[model samples]
Target: MAFPLMKRYFDPWLVRIRNLLKAAQGRPMALVVLFSLSLLNLSSEWPSNMGRPAFVGALDEAVPDSFRTARQLLFDQYQRHFPRIPTAQPVTIVEIDEETLATVGQWPWPRNRLAGLIDAVAALKPLAIGLDIYMPEPDQTSPDKVAANLPETAAALAAALRALPSHEAILARSLRAAPTILGAAALDHATDTASTDLRSAPVLVHGTDPLDSLRRYDYVLASLPELQEAAHGQAMLSVTLEQGVVRHIPLIMGLRDKVVPGLPMEMLRLATGSSAIDVFADGSGVQAVGVADVQVPTQPGGDIWLHFASIRSTLSRYVSARDILKGTVDPQRIRDKLVLVGLTGTGTTDMRTTPLGELVPGIEIQAQVIETIFEGRFLRRPTWLKWAESAFIMAFGLLIIWYVPRTQSRLAVFLRAVPKGSAVLGVSLHLLNVLFCFFIFVRLGLLVDAASIFIILSAVMGCFFAPALLRGDDPIKTQARDAQGREDENDRTGKAPGP
Candidate 1:
């Protein structure tokens, strides 16, 4: 009696489950699995929604890293196909190249020589002059050094050398006289964490304190104290490079909890005569940095995405330091133009890789940033864009979930034509997705993670087809089975089977 009662209570639920499983044997089962997997992929907080992870959380980090490399390659191809033309901006690089080194003496030329260069550039009446070179120590070849190195027997010569002005003083005087913006570097491993009283240009904040949210450094390596005081502005020259490429440049960074402008930002500020920069930020991070009336957008840590100009075009923008010193360069190029002084000499380690795959001077990277800001052609990925991307992924995933099952059902009904039809449909869908992703990227300047999307699509197709192949339910196997059944019947009837 007890056994009968138990069977009556549980038998209906067990039967329903069995019937449901039987109904989901082929196409329906595949669809249900694909949909569930898609939901798991899209709803998760993984770096990218490629597909449902075979094992959750274990491969999460590796997937995004691989996708990033692929995305970078896609971006590189995009840039190659649609290279940016150089804008007619009045920004020039006064490069100390191999030619300049051969013409002028080797680098570490006396500070007086740099002073002379400054004076010459100032005479051209540039809008602003930025030294992408840093002066961490006093000139070693100064007259004071010579005097210290001399013996007592050469007292008269030492006296003459002592009477001569120090190289630092001369450079400081030039800095004071010209519209010069000095360069400084932020040190990550600096032993000194105490903030030095470096002369930083005034930067006023409008919305919220963006200092705490910016990339911070332990210490700053600035120009000589006198030079810093005399210069129109002082800013950081440290650049951040990722995977050997410079894609973004920091416009504002923190050193020992103090905010400092980048070399390019200071040059712009000095050029526009903006005494104080107005930074706008909120809980999200830095939105934009303003100088006078012009506003420039930035990434979370005050870095600007660089839309690098073609390398061929950048060649003309370089004015050799030798020419600048010899007065051979055209004044029109310097007059009212922003001049960046940096070393591009052969032995210099200032070379950096750009999106174009060519190595360029670090100063050129800064110049690109400044020029981009001036032109207001910033590449930005707004906060809302991620949500839009997620929506796209979800929508596409759903479409695949809905379409693949129907395709499987149709293929089963027309098993004889399944091989040819599946091939055509699969190729078409894959190509369509590729074109769609590329179009959105090129047209809208949005990255849609094509790699991840493709992975999801492939996963869906594999799930739908793998079971059929394994169960001998594929088109060729089904036809073979039917032929074998007819042959068996003919043999049982003692008649020869027909082909």
Candidate 2:
């Protein structure tokens, strides 16, 4: 039969393979089995990319100190890269620092003083000025005076949100001249319950109660409701961090089925004239909103990638309220700038953990958000990435098995074949897909561990096939290797060695 004739011609290869099978006997199958399980486990660990609590908790606990240090490094990198890139909107801060506090009196200065500060900032004609401080109530009660009875104490301590109207009046005047955006935090403090008369923006932030960690925020007490009502956008100033480190932020949250940007994000979007900023969900990866022909950069989960400038120095570099109030700073400084108002106090604990494993300052995080929105450079790892990884892993592993063993020497063949063929091909493809978003083919938005799967499958294939090519001799089997070496020498020299 033709089959018999083909087998007769390829008998040497068949013998080598059979010999390898006999050598493997019972030990080689474990690699593939274990590898498959690992792949499955990895897939489940990050399913839908929402991130599991157990895994996040594990990372949090296992790498506690790592978070802060990592954030610092990333922040430094961003600072170095920022000026060179020339972002459209430069981030600035109008801080209510200790010096300003001294000039204007201690914490919660009189409503008129803040109102004057707002007016001064407005005079500079900045694009937007955000008030990081909350105005839940008017300074009706003088805590320093110390009230006697509980009822009298309650009455005296109850403050009106005088700052709201004050800021609104200032904003309205300034808005007529230029653009402006104000900040408001979701309520956790008791002060927000006080003012029914103070106006609030109609839009609200919405999110689920994940472990009730966020349940504390019940409402948003804006300093200027009337002004905010007329403004182009309003955003949530809330930020949750891991171990006091911030790495990522919510671009938008569902509040009453409407999409408004988060504090920094909204401000940046408003500054750039983009009404609808698509904040890709942790669930959806990345979806294009109704933007016209605009491409976006994104993280693996399709959100804007969080990057930061140096937080430590940023706090010190703040433009004080005193400067703005005194007319020393140019309106041009804030003119057309995207301003973010966030607390950097050590006592505050809104932090997040990131890949760099750091607890970054919340304000630095806002800076990152502003930068991303304006630059339009987002982070994304799309779906075709997943299929390409699976394909490359399978093909490269199989080809490595099929080709390398055909050479006369197993180790040498492995090294050469790996460089020229499967190994290089696999590694190159892997880096491209994971790092640069190459497999834009499927657009499915999934990714796998190319290096991991390849390592595992390669190990299995090596066990199954390589030994067969070098059968009748393993390097460790001295007697077999010696006999094969002798045969090889004879063939090369055209004579047997004199023993």
Candidate 3:
């Protein structure tokens, strides 16, 4: 009985929709809806995903640029209102801050002093130490290098200086003392070919090659050979910016035909004593990165959508390098914690603009990534949302194409005074979708693209109503005007007009 009733009501609606589609106006509207669906990649074979051929990829990005920007704005608003609260207490930053720079002397401080700093932190027995700072070149202050530059007359002094161990050796020994992960930088252009052999944590790929999905670098700027040998792990410290701002940080990337983990991922591996990083991917892209018992969800290209927090949050603790070196730092702050060491002084720091609309130290971002992974407070874009949005746009558009013109005749008086009421209805439906997206984001940490829905709906509504709006008069109003004009003419001529 219920099925029969539903069909009785629905069959006529279906027939009406079919008739509407047969109309000349409805044909173009249907085509527009299909075009919008293509933009959202409803068909996978056409636009493909992010790493397609250059022109095709740009077309894909260009079409959805506004949608992406609006989505980012929504994300920024969400972040401001309810940023992720940092719950991983064992992550800390050992900052080489302004005070440390002033106290320990300017950067490029002799490697031995850096060694002392590392030794001090190592003494606290941190679970893992990450050097977000890099030493791409060997220290020029090494005793032998200084000795080689001196005059021959100062051979004895040079010999005495050379007799002592080089500062680099001291630093290398310090690195060995701690389970330290050294930083490497991914470069777009080839520099020295020597660093190609830089050691990296092993990455095990599962299901399909992920090279296309991962960010690629032509070369790498690795640390000194001795330092690389001493460090337990070496990983890229570089980050890819999104529209000149930092949003998602890549967890794994392609470097010189090799897959390597980023700084935070390596640190997590070291902390957990994980032997290797596992990347789970499909033809679409990377799904997640596995480190020991923790599985971290990622963007298709192995990037994690960084859940930002206020800089003042205690999600990660910070301690001054000077204090650590001076033994004034609390031991408890470093005990069993994953410590990231980097410069935070102005002019020498790695600054990134976060979604929270603040410039943050890159090391702090790494800290947040580590905490997010461990605590599993990830913001994800579900794979099905594009299809969901596309279905919504098409279904709502079909409804408008069928219902609007039919209602116009019945609601002539109300619509004539407000021709834009139809457009207003479209906007209200859009707002409802936007609010639903917001609710999903708040309740489940899912990032939905409200902009796509709006864009498609706007196009459909504009096309549907443009002809009526531009023509300036509909048949009903024209007839009413004609009747009124005949009455005026009859009164003027003193003759009755035939009905």
User: What's the distance in Å from true for residue 157, model 1?
Assistant: 2.3
| Model 2: per-residue Cα lDDT over 232-262, one tens digit each | 5555666645444453455543333234345
Candidate lDDT values, in order: 0.74, 0.48, 0.78
Model 3: per-residue lDDT, tens digit, 177-248?
899999888877767543565688899998988998789887788888889999999988878787877888
Best first by TM-score, ranked = 3, 1, 2
- What tens-digit string does per-residue lDDT give for candidate 1 at 17-63? 54443342334554565555444443343433133366655454434
Candidate 3 residue pairs that clash? none
TM-score of 3: 0.84
- C-alpha TM-scores of all predictions: 0.80, 0.57, 0.84
lDDT of 1 at 173: 93
